[model samples]
Target: MNRERIIAIVAQARAGQATDEELQELADALDRDADGSVTSAMEESLQQGRQQIALPGREKADRMLADILETGQVLEDPGEEAETPAVIAPLKPGWKRYGRAVAAAAAILLLAGATYFLLRQSPRPEEAPVAGTNPLAPAAEGLPAGKKAVLTLANGATVMLDEQHNDTITRQGNTSIVKKEDGRLAYQPGNAAATGLALRNKVSTPRGGQYQVDLADGSRVWLNAASSLLFPVDFSGHERVVELDGEAYFEVAPDNSRPFMVKAGQTTVQVLGTHFSVSAYSDETLQKTTLLEGKIKVLAGNTGYQLQPGQQVVFDKIRAGSKLVPQANTEEAVAWKNGYFQFSGADATVLLREISRWYNIEVVFNGIPAGYELSGKIDRSIRLSSIVTALREGGVHCTLEDNRLIVNK
Candidate 1:
């Protein structure tokens, strides 16, 4: 049960020379000696020793054995194989006699491949971060304005509005607008002249918060968290057209002459007067247009399909045939707008990203764990620690450091 006996037994096990009975005895002694703090340590040590023996060369195995014996961290006894060649120990006056040899062995292991592997496999120490700061916590500071607006035209030219970061940019006719330096374009509508150039106007919400906008022709738009909208600065002569790159809900102004159109990626959703949600983030493989009211037509590539109220159409480039699939829970699709991460079994990466955005933290994984689907609702206003605690309860261990979330298995 003492360290010396443990080390001798472990050495024999590593050499692939220990008998079954001897291995069992070693395990018993280790179990008695190691408390709960080292539950997996003995097992890990055994595995590493076995790996060293199994490696192609005898020299490599000896180096591994030396490394283990010297560390004093390895289990004294690892159950089983013990065919280790006898090692000559110099005359030792006392415990100090082993110290110099152990140091030399450590240096030798560094020269061998085992040390390289161990260094690579070792878990990095967590960096000191802002204490008690939860990545998922809601910002104590109120809404922070997002990025600059870049208006794109059908001709492919782009115009940057509010380039100066001035709080007050332009006052035209009855429109009073403010452009904060943070790239947030805040507008107040007023009477507008017909001579003003009509182009698609877009506003994107960054990581912090969401915004709502009313289009020129009375259409109402709710831009969800981390989403953006593109509409006309003023309605043109024909149909009202705009583009979307993220999640947004629209209550279109019904004008048969000026049908509201949403352009998302390769697909276009045309609605006369309907409520629908479009999620077209570039990271997502599928573009979804979910109708909540009235009717809408989704056109992708060469085909066009009509969607009924309460129906969702999904288009994917990777899958063959029609990609549209109905979602059982439509509320989850629009949860971001409502201020929560409404996941009904979402993948880890996507789920983590949402958590990161809400908490304003980075994420790093120790391993590529299996994709686990979890269904839950989290308030965006809550602290990051609260969310991480919930995940830990769900069987995932994570720690926070340097504004980053690190997962450990």
Candidate 2:
């Protein structure tokens, strides 16, 4: 049960050479060691393996672990002793497969003991049954969001955008609204001035849906779940303006004569051409504008502030104030567009709101501990059950009942 022995067992597990007895011994050691030595040994071995061998990045590793758990072979039943063999079969491939085995093995070892203990503990009366619903009932898993949106024409006609629908969806004035081969909505203009230059069109995504729009001006907009964008069918005015609700990422087309502007809530972002994201969910207190490329000016109330690349501005909806972040984590800000949820010390409610929108579920919080924060990155493509498991592993007691995620302190 020494540190070196634990490390050796972990290495064997990673190499797909560990025997059942050795795996059980390691599990016992992890159970007995309350001083964190066993966990440290496992971590050290994982770090050393990563440094010595070629392995996938964190995201890929997470996916591999998820795959293993979904198979229901990596971990034993919670009622049984936590002495499951880390790797039951020899790895077929080389280091690539070995890397995946190790990732799953380490996660199983680390989470097994902790989760078992937490589950074995008795629950208080207040945390017992949530609204008379069975806490132990199997909740239906939520599917990930996909390319689903509705395009509303100038005259209030609607077109559903999805895989089954393609080609020219409709015609608006001189603009032909087409659903491109790549599942994106595009506004292609024909020869002649657009007749209804004053009329506007809108694209909206319901909960658990997302869509992309290629504007007539060549600007591209990626709308997040439960978001909408309203813009003219053709850019004919002095300023190309768009109204946004919820969240969206924009790559504005350059036009010196006409600056592109996005109005979200009480904030307005004006740019000639830039890559940026605007998050202005009505349920959230803060609205943020993050700039990834080029320069832009953010106008909030009567005050205006200029932002450069890698900068962000947060507007407080309650206080009607704004603060500029000189060095922003632009990657975290646009993680949704890139296909994941990246959290760095994010609050519990903040994370729940995102889960609610993406999973299209209701979040009923019995009580969230004050000052609770979470930091991690999860693939957005995973099922809602996986997300709930992750939340439980992070010490956030919660359960999914029907379509509602009930969180308790």
Candidate 3:
């Protein structure tokens, strides 16, 4: 389809003058234009025609979108009945185009209150609204994860670290643990003499929490949700080592005489000075170590693999084997650290697992297709309901009930 035609259709949709045929034509154009040209043209047209249309305010528009997403239907006029198409087919394969089309359609419908249209498939029959149960409405909102963690000192005492608490948290031997103003925990090394022993402290982030720590050795570590890092108060002895429980991104400080090592499960990542991320959640089947800069050697069992920038090493815990990916998707590997969920060809289970961890929710899958996969990016700062809405747009039929997420086929 040509750009001018797409713009005209978009303008008509935004002005509440598009016919059903034109809406279907727009959907077909979105599906055919894999390179996103049609979607971009539609967006541009929407932006250009915004001043011409008398739309609701931003807050009202947001409410409209939320209502539509939650109900999976257009807002009906005062007492008019909503019409249901005879056949509701399944969504097509390409989620990127589908998502864009949904967004565009949502903007048009919410802004102009145009005739209801379905850009893609609607929810299946089994997913219909039940009595006294709104599928998308959670008992309580699942807020986004924040800078919340616990610091365990060597004496078994714990200190809560969060936005409310700041300044010097405690002192461990010659290291002063301080919570910086920006919500990061930092270890300030003093010039005092040697202490009795180098005490080991642990910083752990529970589900729905994340934290960053500046080690005494000048290294920085960002812990993902449900992750922990165990390290000495000071990087004493021959090498600096930290034990990781879940996932973390590391920015190691250069120390030629001493290497920095991160031990997660049976896999060990050794580096002198580098930037990398290690994901070794116990529940996950594969342990991945992705190198973003410099170099590192991953030791899995008896084998060792050298990783360069943009490379990743994956170790299968069940199969007891390791593989190296030459061209790794580094953005997806460190998306958590960068405050987004970037899924590239990710399966439903994988995406839901991450969501469950970040939102601290339990997921119940009911007959979800085995090979279902999606690729998209969502801001991690949004509420769980918004994330669930995005998942639905991406063709994952799911609902948030209290703290549990139920996925239906």
Candidate 4:
């Protein structure tokens, strides 16, 4: 298909003047172009026959799309529709044509009244990102993070939580899956058999995504990007055990009679009830468990280490060797959970890696400069360019190209 022509048609749709055929054609274009790339993942599987079963909140999608097609109006919010009249302005003759405009239109289907897509490719930032990079004249943006995650049921079916879904998602045994307004997935337990074969459900956060889950045992787990948690539908055995592959902050429910345990990589943390966080990503070299309150035992190989409040245990998962640090920066260790990147002279590579995971972008380094470090507190909700600006301010030169951020010494 002529991509430019489709973009033009989508531009009309944004102004509320596209025909029903045009809208359907845009939908078809999006359906055929899911190559496991592109940022508008919310609308990718609509045509992949993945919608065999109706989604919880999908009944109104067709109607909404049809209404916009029939009448030139955008529904910005429920009970709050915006009247956007058409604006006619001609671009310069040599303006570069990009198909991201079409993807932006497709993103609007999932995000009603959305004017622009979040992850659209933009030009490499000049010395000044705000003044020189924006070709379409976007406002000064500090992009705040939103609810983003995926839920995998025991059957292997995956649900993208950031897209369309209703109050109640599913019923697994005695637990009811609920999608919260802020994009958190919670499991509510009913009076079902507490002791039986455990049916496990896993929730995973992609790169540049995070989510919170209320486990069946009344424990709350806040998951960082590139992390997954597997737990049963409800508490069954003498102990509650959940497996973690990435990073998570846990406020374990206190049941002294039945201990709660978290298995992350080669390390296991056993606690009756406590507030703590575990960072154990496979890509990272070290796994650190920081305790906030109460005492817990951490086991690595044959050695066992006990932790108290404000103490953290750092261990090399490969070597099975562990060390404990007192007066841990419990705040800095958990800045991600609190919606910030708190750094205190962190290494340059480490900072960039964390940025890559949170923003869902890749980082390519020109050279790793030794003895380079950065310190600051950056809001996780800010735009990619904002971070790039911060890095530049810290004497690390960088530029954003498409989905990858390139850094230079």
**Residue-wise lDDT of candidate 3 within 1-409, one digit each (tens)?**
7999988986775556888688667766755766768767865665576456444333344444444434433232222323211111124556444555544444444444422222233333344444676666746467879889999999999888874367898888899999998999999889986474879999999999999999999999999999999999997788998999999999999999999999999799999999999999998998999999999999986789999899999999999998999999897899888776665556668768898899889999897646665444445766677566555554566777888888877
Cα lDDT tens digits, model 1, 1-409, are 5545544555554554555465555534433432422223433454556655354444444544444444532212222232221111111122223432333322222222212110101223334433675534443222222333453433455445535455655543345445545544554566555445654446765655566666657787777556777766667567878888777888887899987889988789998998888887776676778888898999876677888766777777677234555543566677676555665435666777666655556678887436454443444554555556445434555666656778754
Ranking by TM-score: 3, 2, 4, 1
For residue 381, give model 2's deviation from the true position in Å: 0.6
Candidate 4, residues 1-409: lDDT per residue as tens digits? Answer: 4555564554554444667577556555544544423223322333321335544443344344433333322232222233221111111111123234333343444333322211111223335444455321233232435567888887888888888476999888778999877767788888756548678989888887888999988899999988999988788789999999999999998998989999998789999999999999998878999999898999865568899999998888677688889889888888899766665546768877888888777788888745554443444655666556445543455667667777765
Return the TM-score for each candidate structure: 0.56, 0.74, 0.77, 0.65
Global lDDT scores for all candidate models: 0.55, 0.72, 0.74, 0.66
Model 2 error, position 56 (Å): 11
Task: Give each prediction's root-mean-square deviation over alpha carbons.
Answer: 21.1, 9.5, 8.5, 18.0
TM-score-best of 1 and 2: 2
Model 4 clash pairs are 143-381, 143-383, 144-381, 145-381, 208-358
For model 2, where is the 10-residue window of minimal lDDT?
114-123
- Worst lDDT window (10 residues) for model 1? 113-122
How many backbone clashes does every candidate have?
Answer: 18, 0, 0, 5
Tell me the deviation in Å of residue 68 in model 3.
26
Which structure among the candidates has the greatest lDDT?
3
lDDT of 2 by residue, 1-409 (tens): 7888877876775555677688777755545545556656766766665566533233333333344334412222223232222111111122122333333343544333222111111222333334765543465578879999988888888777764467788788888989988899999989997675587999999999999999999999999999999999898888999999999999999999999999999999999999999999999999999999999999976679999999999999889888999999887898899776765557778978898999899999888645554444455776777667655644566888888988877
